[model samples]
Target: MAQCASCYFVFCLYCRMVYHGVQPCRLRPGEQRAIRDEYLSATPAAKQAMEKRYGRRTLQLLVDESLTQDWMQENSKKCPHCAISIEKQDGCNKMTCWRCGTYFCWICLVALKASGNPYQHFSDPRSSCFNKLFEGAEELAEDDHEFRRVLVRALPHLSHRSRPRLCLA
Candidate 1:
């Protein structure tokens, strides 16, 4: 017979099962806390083990669901053109959809013309987004500078003849 150091639950050395003469083994405070914490942070494989041991499948499912919802709310935005969820890690308000290739603003979610200069939307005094490229940006001006560098690299591939004429109307 051996005793668990933390919980002091008696167990058989050969069988490695808890020894309960008549009543079930009572969980100690530390053991209960450890089980709760393990269930909360367990991966898929670990969660299986916890489910078998603690029978907390429902609780674990709820926890996973809540975590996923919180993550989506904070880190993702829906593309205005295709309605695809986009996760932007860094850069300016301008976003290009990978699925549909639609250019749009991440801040206002307005779709921009693919044949026109997207930068003009930022510089035009008549536009709502004029001079507000870095508005409400957490990274400050550094993000805008990096975005400009990326745009400059891409400009060489675009044909000048395909550029759309700005309509004053």
Candidate 2:
């Protein structure tokens, strides 16, 4: 909370809007996005200022949440049956949900649990993902060389007991 010395108007310091005690600010959605963007692009000194204003943990949590949401959107899709998020590492479109064991098409997101032959959906001429069972595999394969080079470069120092965990962050 803050008060304008001249106008004597009261407002929330975070949102810069009229104070509403104990209730969340009305400017949250857009305001929060703007703040997040600003914080991400800010310099170390400016980031410290933001951390001082918003608290270090709060700002870190916001940034972590934003990054996680973006990575999930880019790399994962939800199961149509159980709605659980599934990441397709490398394979055909046929995906089995780890949680519910529901078979599904990774490309079309249609449940394949009812079908006797799930691969038939890919072979059918009328299907959207027809002849696309190996869809996106070519791109992944192209990157395999670079990925292998990185792994090979790191292999010299890596030991079975001392290998570091992989982290995308």
Candidate 3:
């Protein structure tokens, strides 16, 4: 939430609408990405102008969050119960959320706590992920391998930077 000094109108920074108490903003799609891209490519003068409009610290935080969110969306899945990003380093499709400890199916993002045997979902005829428990396992393993390689290569240079080097490969 932020306030305009001239108008005294308080609003969400992401949605640019009147502030709502404790509710998530319904921000326009690609809005954050647009801002981040512009900021990243902006000239020093343009960046200064942006910082003047949006505080330097706020803008930096927004850019960082946008970058992190982008990376997370690509590399991880949100826990069904807690919504915390969870990456599968090496495992089966069944996952337990670290934060909430809710058992879930990684492929379908369905909470499996209600099911006595979580793995049964994969064999259940009516389930979406039925017969596909280890779907895309090979592809994901290759991608994770590439990501680890990229991260190892980027680690030295990343120490000097404020943001982690994204492994887009």
Which candidate leads the pack in TM-score? Answer: 2
Ranking of predictions according to TM-score:
2, 3, 1
Measured against the true structure, the TM-scores of the candidates, in listed sequence, are 0.46, 0.67, 0.64
Winner by lDDT between candidate 3 and candidate 2: 3
Count of residue pairs whose backbone atoms collide, per candidate: 0, 0, 0
lDDT of 2 by residue, 1-169 (tens): 9999999999988779888776644435556667778998999999998887777666665665565566578779999988989987777888899999998898889887455887888999999989988898777665656655765566554444434466533
Candidate 3 lDDT, 2-72, residue by residue in tens: 99999999997766888875555443556767766887899999998777655676577677567657778
Cα deviation of 121, candidate 2, in Å: 0.5
User: Once model 2 is optimally superposed onto the true structure by TM-score, how far is the C-alpha of residue 6 displaced, in angstroms?
Assistant: 17
lDDT of 2 at 155: 52
**Using alpha carbons, what is the TM-score of model 1?**
0.46
Worst 10 residues of 2 by lDDT: 155-164
Model 3 segments beyond 4 Å from truth? Answer: 1-32, 51-58, 152-169
> What is the full ranking by lDDT, best candidate first?
3, 2, 1
- Model 1's alpha-carbon lDDT is 0.65
